[model samples]
Target: MNILITGATSGIGKELALQLTSKGHKVGLMGRRTERLQELKDEIGDIAFIRTLDVTNHEKAEEVYNSLIDEMGGMDVMILNAGIGRIQMLPPWEAESKLIEVNALAFAHGCHFAMDYFRNRESGHIVGMSSMAALLAHHRAAAYTASKHFISNYMKGYRQKAKRMNADITITEIRPGYVWTEMTERAKGMFWVAPVEKAVSQMVTGIEKRKNYVYVTKRWQLLAWVAKLVPEWVWDRL
Candidate 1:
């Protein structure tokens, strides 16, 4: 299958490109770092296509993605994996606003492009990188959590729209709890962190199965249920 993934410089996006291309799938990767993109292309060899662009630049991103789709003949799957996160200290609006831009607006850009492509073809898959934070609000990172919530709901809305239009499209929202990637490597007080490979393996399975929503590592499903079951004040205490 032809697959295009945004934010492929590192972490889950990079690993997914590696694993998928190693398995003989044609993969297209977009990232801001040219050197990193080149390195990934060298590592993955001929099956990989590399384009350097910031996902937040919606117009350029669309052009690059459309070129990738054309180069690969067509895209079977598109993964909107570009995101940013940080623990706010004070005067949080700056970080919060950036988070919303990268995590939410960038995501919408990719989703719009993919939806248009898929709708015209009548068959395709879109996989979004939401987080378990979508299920609960985080005190230190409210914007990050809120952005993920936006992603979850946005994907669900597309799911419903596709159904209404009788389009043969799949919307898969991947809500990962904690994966040990560069994004979380410096994070303190982390819990239940799964290895990148472990998380990606499960994520790939869910994508292949075209699941509407899935928690990485499976065990996170328990946490999600508990999060919903617990009362607000009780949750705050934990």
Candidate 2:
């Protein structure tokens, strides 16, 4: 399959590229870091197409997506993996706004584009990188959590739309717990942190199965169930 992965420069995106390419799939890589993109292209060779552009740049991103699809002859999947956490402390509004733009807005754009393409062709797979935070909120990362919630709800709507359109479009939302990537290496209070490879391997399997919602590493489902079962008053204390 021909797949395009955003944020392919590092972490899960990079690992996905390596694994998928090793499986003989053509991958189109996009990220803001030119050097990192080049490195991936070099390592993945001819089957990898690299493009440097922020996912927030919607126009350019669409163009690059199409260009890569052309290069690969066709596109079968779009992985909206580009995302950022509240990794640094900034002014409240600034941090929240940035997270909204990259994680929520940009992700919505990718979904919109992929749905359009797939609807035309009547088949495609869209993999969105959501988080367990979609079910729980953090006071320190309110916007980040809220954004993921939006992704979950929004993707649900799109799923209905796919059914309405009668298109063979699969929208898979990945709600992952802590995974030991650069993103979570320094995170405090993390438990059951799956190795990046193991986490992404499950992700690939879930994506291949075209599951609507995937809780990475499987054990995360216990936490997800707990989150749903816990009383709101108890969570208010946390």
Candidate 3:
């Protein structure tokens, strides 16, 4: 299958690219880092196409998506994996705006573009990258959590619309907990971090199976469910 993945320069995105390309799937890799994109293209051989585009740039994102769709002869799946997380120590108003811009607005635009394309074709899959933080509010990462919650809920709504229309489209929301990526390396308890390969593997399998929602790690799914059942007062004490 042909797949287009954003934020393919590093972490789960990079691992997914490598794994998918090795399995003989055509991959269109999108990222802000041209150097890393070129390196991945080199490593993956001719089946990999690299696009140096930022998800935050709406016009560039649309152009790149069109070009990738044309290059791949139409995409079977689009993975919305580009995201930024900021642990703000200041007041919520200060950092909240940028967080919404990157994690929420950019993601929403990507989803809109991809969905339009897929709806026209009447067949496609969308995999959205949300976080387990969406299920529980974090003190320093309020904006990040809020943005993820937005995406998660948005995908859920989209799923309902797709079902009603009988569109041959699948939308998967991935909620991952702590991952061992550069962004989360400075986080405490590195030992508990989920391996990038394992997470990507599970994601690929879930996407292939057309699962509606998945937590990259089994433990995270359990935690999210448990968090939902916990009393508000008890959760506040954590």
Candidate 4:
């Protein structure tokens, strides 16, 4: 399969690129760091094709995605994995808004492009990197959590739209709990932090199965159920 992954320079995106390439899939990697992309290409050999650009630059992201899709002989799947989450409040509204831009606006951009491509081809998959934060609100990172909520619902809307249109496409939302990655390296007091490899392994399996939604590390599935059951009073306490 030919795959495209945004934010492929580090963390979950990087792991997905590497693991998928090892499985003989042609992977198109997109990120801002050209040097890191080079390093990944060097490690993965010819299977790795990279386009160095930030997803926030909507025009450039769309341009590079189309070019890379053709470069990879057309993409079978596009992973809308580029996102940002900073544990800060509204005092620094810039940081909070930036989180919304990347997590929601940029995600919408990628999803729209992928949906268009899939609609034309009548076959493809769109995978979104959402978070458990979508299920529940967080105090310190209100914008981040809300942005994820947008992502979760946005993907669901796309899924429903595709179904109604009778389009042969799939939307998979990956909701991960804490994982040990550069994104979480500075986070404090995190629990049940799965190793990056372990998290990616489960993610890949879920993607392969084309599941509508998946919780990383498998154990998070239990938390997901419990999360839905919590009342407002209990949720406020947590």
Candidate 5:
């Protein structure tokens, strides 16, 4: 598969590029960091292509994605993994709004672009990197959690759209629990945090299986089940 991954500089995105390319897949990598993307391209050699792109830059992102697809010949999957996480509300609306831009709006931009590209071809996969926070919102990370909720819900809607369109477009929503990545290295009260490589391995498996929803590390599936049983009053109190 020829796959394009946004935010491929570090964390799960970087790991996904390495792992997928190791399995003989061509990977188109995009990130804000040129040096890191170069390192990945060097490491992966002919199978890896690098583009410096900030996914929030909508116009540039579209150009970058199309350019990579042109370079790769074709793209089989688009992983919308570019996102931001905020653990506080101290700075108020500005920081929160930026989180919305990257996590929600940029994600939507990627999704819309990928859907258009795939629909024309009649077959493709779209992966969205959401979080367990999508199920259980946190007070300290209100914007971050809500943004993930948007990701998951938006993907669900697209899944339905794909069905109605009768296309072979797979929309996979990855809801992962705490994994020790650059994004969550300083996060407090973390538990059952899977290694980034391990998490991405499970994610790769899920993507290959064409699963609609994947909970990384397997144990997180139990949490997802419990979350649905929690009452609104309980969540409101938390």
Candidate 6:
């Protein structure tokens, strides 16, 4: 299968690209770091194509998708894995809105683009990387949590719309608890940190099974459900 992954420079996106390419799948890697992209291309040999792109740039992102589709002949899957997470302890009003732009708006655009392509071909998969944080409000990372919630909700709506239209496109939302990626490397003492390889392996399995919603670790699923049962006061205490 031919796959296009955004934010392919680091963390889960990079790990997914490596895993997929090693499995002999054609991969189109999209990221802003040309150096890392070139390194990946060299390491992965000819099956991997690198596109230096910033997902937040709507025009560039659209162009990259079209170019990749043309270059690869066609894409079987599009993974909207590009995201940013930062601890924002300030008032919500003072937080930078770029988190929303990157995590939510960029993902929405990718979903729309992928849906258009898949709708035309009448077959394809759209995978969005949300976080378990979407299940609850986080005090220090309000924007990040909100963005993830938006992603999860957006994918849910897309799934419903696709079902109603009888579209062949399958939308999968992956909610990971905590993975040992560069983004979370600084988060020490977090026992929930699953190795990147482990997380990606589970994610790949879920994708192959066409699971609509998946938690990378099974424990995350239980935690998400438990979080929902917690009262606002109890949640705030965490």
Better model by lDDT: candidate 2 vs candidate 5: 5
Candidate 3 backbone collisions, by pair = none
Q: What 10-residue stretch in candidate 5 is worst by lDDT?
A: 83-92
53-141 per-residue lDDT for model 1 (tens digits): 88888888888998988888789999999998884564678778888999999998899889999999999999999999999887877
lDDT of candidates 1 onward, in order = 0.90, 0.91, 0.87, 0.92, 0.93, 0.88
**CA RMSD for every model?**
1.5, 1.1, 1.9, 1.5, 1.3, 2.0
* Better structure of 1 and 2 per lDDT: 2
Q: Write the per-residue lDDT of candidate 2 for residues 109-223, one digit (tens) a residue.
A: 9999999999999999989999999998878779999999989988999998998886899999999999998888778999888999999999999988999999998999999
Candidate 6 whole-model C-alpha lDDT, 0 to 1: 0.88
**Per-prediction TM-score, please?**
0.96, 0.97, 0.94, 0.96, 0.97, 0.94
Candidate 1 C-alpha error for residue 169, in Å? 0.2
- What TM-score should be assigned to candidate 6? 0.94
lDDT of 3 at 75: 94
The runs of at least 3 residues in candidate 4 whose Cα sits more than 4 Å from the true structure, single-residue gaps closed, are 87-91
TM-score of 5: 0.97
**111-135, model 3: which lDDT tens digit per residue?**
9998888899988999999988888
Candidate 6, residue 59: lDDT: 91
Cα lDDT of model 2 overall? 0.91
Candidate 4 clashes between residue pairs 3 or more apart in a chain or in different chains: none
- For model 5 the local lDDT of residue 57 reads 91
lDDT agreement of model 1 with the native: 0.90
Model 5 misplaced stretches (Cα beyond 4 Å): 87-90
**Clash pairs of candidate 1?**
none
